[model samples]
Target: MIVKCIDNNNCSTLTLDKEYPVIAEAPEYYVIFDDKNQETTCKKTRFTIIEDDYFTQKAKATITELNYQLENEFKDIKQFTIRKNSKGEIKEISVKFKYY
Candidate 1:
């Protein structure tokens, strides 16, 4: 089995061999933090990722903990907020989805 993974600092993805399934809510933009400062960016819908979080060694443990927390904290979260750029593109939006 092969698993694919991709990361963009503020966002990270993990895909298992095309068998095991994982689901998540989509966000328009993602917020990131760096030594310089915090920033936001656009994200395309094609992979599994978590905004404001990374799948890294230093963060692996934290991410795992968050996964469990989100599942329960957002049990009834049918809506969230996502920020967008002036260009009308999803950029630097919050990890939270924006519900109508």
Candidate 2:
């Protein structure tokens, strides 16, 4: 998710009004990549969400999610491949379930 800094809270690494990319998040804090590309945690009140990114929206991308789905939801013979580019970006996701 993208977030714009509204309050630095006296953090020297933060610049007021600067936008940052939140690489990870939970309920109360955002793990944002700072201006220097350093991973840092900031309170949720420190910024306002600008937009949700791929990670936040990719509901079934994580291994845990895939395991749950493949086990409980798709309990059939299957094959899958998650294609990625050289840059490690997901290009395609292929799943083949049992013909039954």
- Measured by lDDT, the strongest candidate is 2
Candidate 1 residue lDDT tens string, 1-100: 1112343344333222221122322355323322234332324332344333234555688566557658888653455576787888986433443265
| Alpha-carbon runs more than 4 Å astray in model 2 | 54-100
lDDT of 1 at 88: 85
Per-residue CA lDDT of model 2 for 22-71, tens digit only, reads 88898999998887888999899999878777665675466666687768
Q: Which 10-residue span in candidate 1 carries the lowest summed lDDT?
A: 16-25
